[model samples]
Target: METTSKGTEDKGISRARFLAGAAALGLAGAVLPATGAQAADARAGRAGRPGRGLTRRGVVYTVGAGETPGTAWDPARMRADVRSIRHDLHANTVDVTGDGVERLTATAAEAAERDLHVWLQPTLGDVPQRDILEHLAECGRFADRLRGQGASVELSVGCEFWLFVPGIVPGETVLERIENLQNGTADPEQVQRRLTAFTAKAAAVGRSVFGGRLGYAAAQDDEVDWSLFDVVGIDYYSYHEHPADYVRELRRYLRWGKPLAITEFGTCTYAGAPQAGGMGWSVVDYDKDPPEIKGNLVRSERTQAAYLTDLLSVFESMGLYGAMAFEFLSADAPHRPDDPLHDLDMASYALTKPIRDRPDDPASPWHWEPKDAFHALSRRYARTC
Candidate 1:
């Protein structure tokens, strides 16, 4: 999710202007009215035509992740989140990503209870080949367990292996790998060869134990051999310079003859965040003890909503398998009510505002409020084609 000198930065679209455009397009008012019958009618309209308009409407529910504080493991909260996705967002799938096996299995099981397909992605960050295989086997074990429970699950072998895992590329840190690639120090041919070899091995090991769909979150620019898996997955993010090519670039996946999954895509909660994919994570200065905005940035929830709606349209129009929003929430980047201007949560790609102080019993479910994107996504996903 981090990049070097790709020259792709936020284009700084005016929030007010984008919202004005959305209002004119009727997207702002497209949210389903708060009534169960109306929602059911809207959903029934699409029942006849399946696999249209992101049939696998999905969001990545990240837990126990590295950069963001792990969502506290609560089965009740997990059930609520899954139900919310199925009922409110009209999503049929959940990309349950995390590191630990226990949390990953529990999340997948809960999503299964809600009848949502699960993309089980476990992060084994910056480890060697042996460790990677070990993690893959662990995922396979959990996938089998979930299957025994009759849960639908797909095992993502790993994410961005060339960048994060060792032996595949020559860099001590993720940033270092990016620097090497930019400086012509990392051989492209050698890197691709190592990646292909390692990925093939991962798929082989994963398939041995995991009896379900398999794929890797290949970086958009990476030349991955897709024959090893059932799904062609890409962590696609729009760039400022290549706005028009977004759909055109994704069409190449059709050549793989596998289900195309946009494994990750989403915008931050700012005016220009739609185009902030490549460099969004790097924009903030994290050197300080507590990260804050690097400069004055305008908060525009509509920009994110617009970006998501447009991308969903492209995915649906193309008749691709499915896509997952980068994330449902960023628990660590909680809202800053006191310093609203410095609320880094606004920069989060998540569709909800993470609240830190839970004003109730310690056992109360975690509280999070939705953004405009959440409602917009619900409306868009509810449509048929």
Candidate 2:
């Protein structure tokens, strides 16, 4: 669920394919508003409070780069997207992901306008492990700026370190690491050790520059040193390996005795997608010229809606701090109902499909159509838990 726009195509496509397969805020006791200035005021009230109630009912707002240039980061598009998430999707928070400081800043400002609390993550695509701190330091600078403006933001130093950042894992590239993983050649313990060591350093630097909450987005199976963070964040995708024990799996995190948040969760728009879960998108052939499904495929928006509703129910039952759906939109995977080969949206996990052409009407500001998950989440978020 954590991705960067500027990532290499091979790396990007590997992720897109893997993702075709698979897929926070703290406030202890404050009630949240559905929207408007009141929501902003409510979040402002819990900016740094420890005992505040769950405030991160969120959806990730993303714009990717590389082959899918349609989804590349744009300030104007970000503004419109943030607004839709606030007024239309009914999310009170957003986890904004982008490559550089400027993009993250633009995203943060727009989220603030919509009264959304944020988890700001830098997309550290191919940065060497030695220099990762520099990127995170930029994030700290942005965090300081936003905090000055009274925005509720958490600085995530990095995500899925083993795959994204070099040196921590066996390979210099993500695809290499992924191959190592698939072949069972990569050692999980070794990856965890390096990640822990690097995160300790990142936490120290992040704490010095930004005075608010700080956390790292760890993969579900990777154990992190929770002492390094104020909040325990995990990018969990429910492949539903053990439905009956799902809550039990999450409960183990409470041993950290910190606020736990599901940093990412959701599936693609296709029949049996919920069953495919995190691995749904990975089913596509990345080697194909334009990336197509390996065999027969069926598109079903409802499958995605079901995935969101089911996961949200589990999150609410777990009584965890908060959760964000994997994403609000994917700009690159434009919808093409006219041509099956060009209909790349079947591989996308976004809540809405990007429109190939904008309508001539000024009234029609949106460039995408809401899928079933959008309505499902909007209705769910409209209610108070």
Candidate 3:
């Protein structure tokens, strides 16, 4: 992996210069009008909506690692790490999983020492409806843990359930399962009713816990039940064909009067190779395979960097609230040696090569190294903050 110094100053581009540059790049007509001055101001840290800011105050935490410190809760070490990350990255928000509440609370206290925000990406197992009430009840019980630690928490009940449901189950079976899970029966009509009921219940539960502010992460556009969330969260791996498209999508969501966050956004370096561990949901591979292929899609470091730059640019222009890269490190295990075709096959592709050490090692090919994209994003965040 190649390391590059992050430039401290903005590569000053005036409106006219920006237009000229866009025209030269054949994007002037396509992006200028839709992304007007308001958006531009948002990016520039000038005029912003109530909670919108260009500061890159975001970090994505893994289930048992990354932000969590030590085998157990070593308060001193956790505080040091949290302070280091916040000071170094200018991060204001750190995402924590539900099961990791104890560690999350510990980290939140550390964050409080540094004055940062915390968002909880609560993990509900495959069967959310099985104990939806119980799941929510636990969240209520945990709310005090968050408040006690001097951290405000946004409860993310489910992540990417859309992929697990309709993406995997047949339509008829999908309806049946939804019905069974929601209402204790397998009737299609009941399925729709249950979904509606669940949305209301979830929203009510969230409002009671977070004072009417709730967040949810969705992997696909279709998975979003907008009525259930105050803020819409999305995880995009390959949706960004270009930077302009990213801007357009953000604008679409911004119109809803709700803030938008790119909860998880990163490119897989492997292209089309099967994800090493079959751990994530992906649409393509990086090895120049046809879109229909089921594997990791490999893109060069330069391409990845450019994509990230464009993404950040769009986020700035659209007045987006914030974004978190998919991860800070690589997976702990190699592609599951026993099942190469599993969902996580593309897991290793998310990290930069240097972090991984040996990108070619299949057994433990997954490692965390900062690639050009990481630096680019870090620099961008540093500047904006």
Candidate 4:
């Protein structure tokens, strides 16, 4: 379960929708926690490797500029958003994920200009595998160009291929495929084999074009052959259903001796979200014309804020290479304080709430208000290092 927060509405796939089913099964009975000596070694290993983890704090930003009406992607607005990420959230790194090669690389350039480390992730869906491969080639070329200019840039080829890549999973779209996984129709063993094969080829393609760091954002279900990557990227979100010792679970990734990074980790804005983890976004009802959260999910920015600091503590204890908050902003999920049903931001994992456009006041400039999670990250990151 790769707890995705891609928010790739621009790609014709609702990121939360596709990922909801993946996190449904939960880790309660699936994976047991390491105890006794195993737990002690996990802690000992972390302590022995001093100064090896979480040297940088970061956040994820999706840029689907001009791809959709609801997506907030004005170049001027994005520049300001990047400024917020650096100055407000105090993040030293930024993971840029989305479809367009130009937009993805352009956002990386923005982060580079600000002296922030950049992770360039090209997330494409519902497209041919060849097209995806081509997209990766272009992204690598651009990332290498950034590196040539002395920018700290790494290329994450893609994420959670079991759902995004067409044939790896059972269904036609990402959502359907995930539902299949949840329904026990998809073979986990078959998915793993295909995932490894696809990742090896993707890593090779990335290395061929890019000279900097290369990796993939793996899901919890993926058994990645880490030898192909320069870094181990995992999207970590604690499952509230059955809490496992995160330190114990993460220790396995350390075996490779590569820098381990949490490429995505964050909860939604509503109550009980901290427990739901990645599936917190499942509350949204997309069938509506404008789309909004389902039923009565009470909004609680405090819940989101607490989830942030708690996970940061765990990441620090484990000493990760970096921990990027699932996202900085969700353009597709706008804030509607007056309308709870229509407050799409409630299900969003973004730190900031993008205000939906007002037909009555079209003259008002594009704007978004930072949620409490944003402040929590700022305080924690500012104190860090």
- Which candidate leads the pack in TM-score? 4
What's the C-alpha lDDT at position 106 in model 3? Answer: 58
Order the candidates by TM-score, highest first. Answer: 4, 2, 1, 3
| Model 1 misplacement above 4 A | 1-51, 65-76, 240-244, 358-366
Q: TM per model?
A: 0.80, 0.83, 0.60, 0.87
Task: Report the Cα lDDT for candidate 3.
Answer: 0.46
- Candidate 4 backbone clash number: 1
Write down the RMSD of candidate 4 (Cα, Å).
4.2
TM-score of 2: 0.83
What order do you get sorting by lDDT, best first?
A: 4, 2, 1, 3
Compare candidates 2 and 4 on TM-score and give the better one.
4
Model 3: per-residue Cα lDDT over 1-385, one tens digit each = 0000000001221111222222233321111122254455334432224334554356665433321112222455456556645775556676654334455455655565566666666543334354544555565456556666555656665454422223222232222333333443334344334444555566666666665357766543332357678787766544445655555445545544677777766544444322221222223232332112253344345555665566656666766777776554334222333333432323333333322234334333233345566677667777755
Better of 1 and 3 by TM-score: 1
Better of 3 and 4 by lDDT: 4
User: Best-fitting candidate, measured by lDDT?
Assistant: 4
Question: Local error of candidate 4 at 249, Å?
Answer: 2.3
Distance from true position, residue 316, model 4, in Å? 1.6
**Model 4 lDDT per residue over 1-385, tens place:** 3343343555655565554434453322122123364455445543214444477699988876432553546677778889988888888999998878777877899999999999999987667778888998998999999999999998999987766788787777766765676668877767767777888888989999999889889865356778999888988777543224666667766876898888988989988887776567767666566565777789999988988878787778767788899888776667888888888789888899878468223243446898999998999888863
State the displacement of the C-alpha of residue 282, model 3, in Å, after optimal TM-score superposition. Answer: 6.0
